[model samples]
Target chain A: MSVPTIKFYVREGLLPPGELTSPNQASYGETHVQRLRLIRALLDVGGLSVAGIRGVIEAIDDPRRPLHTVLGEAADQVVPRYERGDGSGIAEARKRVAELIEARGWRTYEGSPAAESLATALAALEEVGHGRFAEILDAYADAAERVARVDLEYVAHQVAREELVESVVVGTVIGDAVFAALRRLAHVDASDRVFGETP
Target chain B: MSVPTIKFYVREGLLPPGELTSPNQASYGETHVQRLRLIRALLDVGGLSVAGIRGVIEAIDDPRRPLHTVLGEAADQVVPRYERGDGSGIAEARKRVAELIEARGWRTYEGSPAAESLATALAALEEVGHGRFAEILDAYADAAERVARVDLEYVAHQVAREELVESVVVGTVIGDAVFAALRRLAHVDASDRVFGETP
Candidate 1:
């Protein structure tokens, strides 16, 4: 990380300032290094904005919040909020998302950010004449549930609360990238099988 | 989308020019509208860059290329190429990825984009002192395989090759967003179940 970037993170309250040990020099610790890496991962890999990272950092630093709550909030903050216009397509998509959640027996909160993100994606699909794509919602949900099970199991292994929180944040963000890449790889394999192409 | 944005896409050759009826009158057909919506979804939701989307469009528009070839090229183009700087961490991660692929019996190409992307993510995890996260690779790959199965099944329903190519492109890009969102929702539910939090 560059000096200006570190300064910017400190200025934006995404990272804590180094300890002032000298008149013109400050002493940084391992936490600073670790936080900087996390911030870079979130920005570069997670595609989060500075403000979004700030929200996540704030949630992490708050001691009173439960771990799961912080995780939910941080996950929610990463996705950009979409404005719901008078488009009936989005409304219809939102209803489909609700029905999928109900049918799957998923216990998500009302107005879950993920639900909104799914609705936005569904609406875009409809706009492009792929409204029928919603037919695969159950399949996607099944895979998502399996992925989540593994993720939670991994995070559960962390003994430290701080480490646990940080793990969720990092895992949720970078894990998305990891899963996406794997999905693409799997796509290639599946396509090869379907088209009789040699890998 | 805005006029200038559409103009930029047209200038970039990412979108075809609208039909000209007069000197200052141009009419965009359904193809243009659908392409614009796809572009927006890739940009806004999929978080792909202009250059990346351009490469994908190029692959899709090329008739000589086979379907699987186009899918691989498009997937490769989305991930920002990461240069290995004699870093043992990335090297180690790459090796792990190779092992995971072999153990899973997945027939991915050498230096696959997904492998490179996974290495980048793993290296980042190591940078943040979470290198152990690689231990969960099998679980992730399993879920990814299932998701890809469903994705391919959905795309297989498209009888037209043109629609098949478009489906893979759209499904790969928007599908990432859709899956990521669902994963987050699953995380919330999983966390709730694990932590005994009432949803």
Candidate 2:
């Protein structure tokens, strides 16, 4: 990164400034480099705005925030939020989301942002005349549980809480992009075998 | 849906106009109602721009495009595209993507947008100091394959080709959101169980 870009991150409070070596010059340490990399990943890969990046960065810097709180904030920044419309479809979708948690025997908060995100997607599927698509919910939930278990198990070995938090935040955000991309590739592969064609 | 909303979809070429009955009134049918629902779902749920919806509507109207092409286009519109920067990070990322396809024995297109999307995501993970995250990718791929098989099986039973296309398009777009939400929920559950805490 250029000096100007580094200074810009400093101005935005996205990166802490290096130690002052002289009146007008500072020496950046390894931590600054790490922070810059994180800022880039959150912006470029996670597609988070500067404000969203700031929110998660704050959470990361604060040790008092519980693991769940950090994870939720990280998810909030990554997942799309809505100014939800008051429609019957949404109401039905919300009910289905609640039932999914119950049916799966998950202890996740029924009203979490993730739950609302699921509801919005469900409502959209219903509106699109693909209401039957919900039949595959259990299948998707099953797959998701497996992946999430892999995720937690991977992070469990990190000795520092800071590393664990960083792992959770980065994993939650970029992990979504990773899984979505893999799912699309899997679709292409499956469709080819089933339909006897190639892309 | 209101008259003006329907009129807007027609104006945007997202919905076929109703059959003309008189100069001031056109008789709407079941198709119009269904199209309106699709428009609503695409706009509100899929978060597609009007132009994106127009593109998909045109594809849905044209049977000349094969299933793979239409599916690619649908996936293209849903996945976030990038003005990729020429950096060593991205170059390495692309190499890993090709390796993943080869290792998995997938016959999918190497340069498909979905593949590029995955590459971008992996690159981002590398950038954020979690290159090790890719180690768990096979686990994710395994889960994705299961879900994709379920998806193909569900859509295969659709008798009509148009219905199949519709199912694939809606499933690809909304399914990502659904899977993402479920993954977060699963994380919440797994973290609670492993850490002995509640959100």
Candidate 3:
């Protein structure tokens, strides 16, 4: 939290400007501190770019926006866009993603960014000759469902609409990191058990 | 994917140089192509750095490295290292991570990179006044265990030790991306269900 970084966020409109108490000085409130903390959390831990953070903060501050719309935008902004490719692997992967969604009875939107992200990963797996990895889609979806349920439960507990929206944005991004780390730990444990290796 | 990128990878030792077929001409084989794809997948899709890809390639090329050891190294390499902090939030988050691991009966190493990563996320959440988000740890870990079982089972079916190691590396990295995407989709569905919003 350097002065320059704080100034940068304020300049970028990711954080609100402090109130001017004098010609040469501004008085920062607790809200500014909290906002700065959230900004840092999103940037450092969530691995979001400045532009991505701006989008999230804009969604957070815009009361006219619907909560679901805000969440969708935040999630979409965080995921990298996949370029349209004519590769068969990508086409097949897209089909696989749709089938997985259908098989799992997930009610995601058509052309969901998550679906595209999954498709990109599947295509990459196929490109690397791990096409068979798609076989684990069901398992991955099952786990995803369970985690998502927990996330929604937490967000639903928020009484304030603004808090709920912010929770969804933060939870979606930081929760991904948390779950990924947990998955890695679980992988280590499972691999050790399967191979008879001591931890 | 480009000539320059391939040359860069070769220079970085992340990809091996092509064999010289003549005084001024070099030819690459299937191994080179596959290696190049793996490097690209790791860099472009897996979000690993050149140095991180180098570590993964080295692990893959080393026959003497045990599968679990190689997987650990690869997973460790992908996660950003957390700087030592004296903040109580970080210290508290670390304790929570340890508690979550113990409660879940996971056999992760004492200073496991996953644990550190989780602690870092937890700390960030707390920094943003979302310490209560740690409540979802048990649920996340449960889902993570289920996903890890499927991953290990898939790796176990690999006939060759090299394939097994590579699968773990790929599975740990790209699997995170895949699962994150799936989780986002699941989040959309769950949020819709909870808030009564149409997808």
Candidate 4:
């Protein structure tokens, strides 16, 4: 990173200021290097907005925030947000998501943004005339559970608290893009099986 | 759905011009109405750029593009794009993706952007020190296949080719958001299982 870039991250509170060695000189340590890497991952690989990156950094720096909930705050902004007008099937969609959570017996927090994000997506599917897509939600949940297990296992292996939170945050956000891209490739494979070649 | 939005879509070449009954008294039929819905869904739900929606419309309008290829075109831009510097592990990632495709016997096109997109993601994972995350590719591929099959089945049931194409395009983009949101919620559940309540 350059001088200006490091200064910028410092201004944004994304990184800690280096040790002031003189009126014009400063020194950074290993923590600075690791934070720089995390910031780069969030921006370049995760495609997080400035605000989203800030949210993740805040969660990390806040002592009051629980370790388990840190990634959730970072993730809320990292996931694309959405809304709908009245009569847009949003109410019913929310209800359905609520039922899925209840039926699954998952102990998540109240009003977690992930639930709303799922609801908004379901409503959007309905508005697009593909409400039937929701039928496959169970299958998707089953798959996602398997993935989250893999992810949590990776996260659990981290010895440091900061390392564990950062691990899950990166896994949750960038891992989304990874899974989505893989999904598209798999679509090509599945399409070939179902529809065959253009010829 | 409003007049100005409809005109905007027409101006952007996303919707066909209404038949000019008079200088300012053009009449639109069922096709226009359907096209309008698709435009809204792409904008509000899919979070696609104007350029992406235009790409989809062009694929729909062009005569030479095959049915199997249309969604692929729209999907390339819809899926997030990424890149990396030299010695960033990208070359190795690309080779791995190619091997995966060949191993799976998927007959997708040469240099398909989706393949490149997947490579970029895997490379990013490595750059972030989560290269082992790629180990779960088979699990993700399995889950994605199930979702894609369900998507194709719903698309196949549509009576008209136009409707079928629109169904798949809408499903592909919006479905990405839906699945990502679901994955996060599932993570919360998995976290509870692995770590219990944070005390």
Which structure among the candidates has the greatest lDDT?
Answer: 1
Candidate 4, residue B140: how far the Cα is off, in Å: 1.9
TM-score of chain B taken alone, candidate 4: 0.88
Candidate 2 chain B least-lDDT 10 residues? B79-88
lDDT against the true structure, each candidate: 0.84, 0.83, 0.84, 0.78
Q: Please state the error at residue B168 of candidate 4 in Å.
A: 1.3
Error of 2 at A144 (Å): 0.2
Model 2 over residues B1-199: C-alpha lDDT tens digits?
A: 6678778878889988888888887998888888877766666656667888788878878998888667667777877655446573878888888998899988788878888988888877777678898899999999998998898888887888899888888888778878988999998888888774653
What DockQ do you compute for every candidate structure?
0.69, 0.67, 0.75, 0.63
Most accurate candidate by TM-score:
3
lDDT of 4 by residue, B46-142 (tens): 7788888999888877767667777787688686576456567878998988887887666665467888777877887776677887777777777
Task: Let me know the TM-score candidate 1 reaches against the reference structure.
Answer: 0.94
Alpha-carbon shift of residue A193 in model 2 (angstroms): 1.5
Prediction 1 global C-alpha lDDT:
0.84
Q: Residues A1-110, candidate 2: write the lDDT tens digits.
A: 68888788788878877899899878988888888888877887677788888899999999888877788899887766554476648888899999989988898777
Worst 10 residues of 3 chain B by lDDT: B81-90
Comparing 1 and 2 on TM-score, the stronger one: 1
Between prediction 1 and prediction 4, the one with superior TM-score is: 1
lDDT for each residue of candidate 3 in B1-199, tens digit (9 for 90 to 100): 4788889888999878889989878999999988887887787678888899889889989998877888888898888747535464877788888887787788887578889988988898887777789787789888988999999888888998878888888888899889989888988887777775473
Misplaced by over 4 Å in model 4 are: A1-3, B1-5, B28-30
Residue B176's C-alpha lDDT in candidate 3?
Answer: 86
Q: State how far residue B66 of model 4 sits from its true place (Å).
A: 1.3
Score residue B14 of candidate 4 by CA lDDT: 88
Poorly placed runs, candidate 1 (over 4 Å): A81-88, B81-88
TM-score versus the correct structure, for each prediction = 0.94, 0.90, 0.96, 0.91
- State the lDDT at B45 in candidate 1: 68
Model 1 residue A93 distance off true place after TM-score fit, in angstroms: 0.5
| Candidate 4, DockQ score (0 to 1) | 0.63
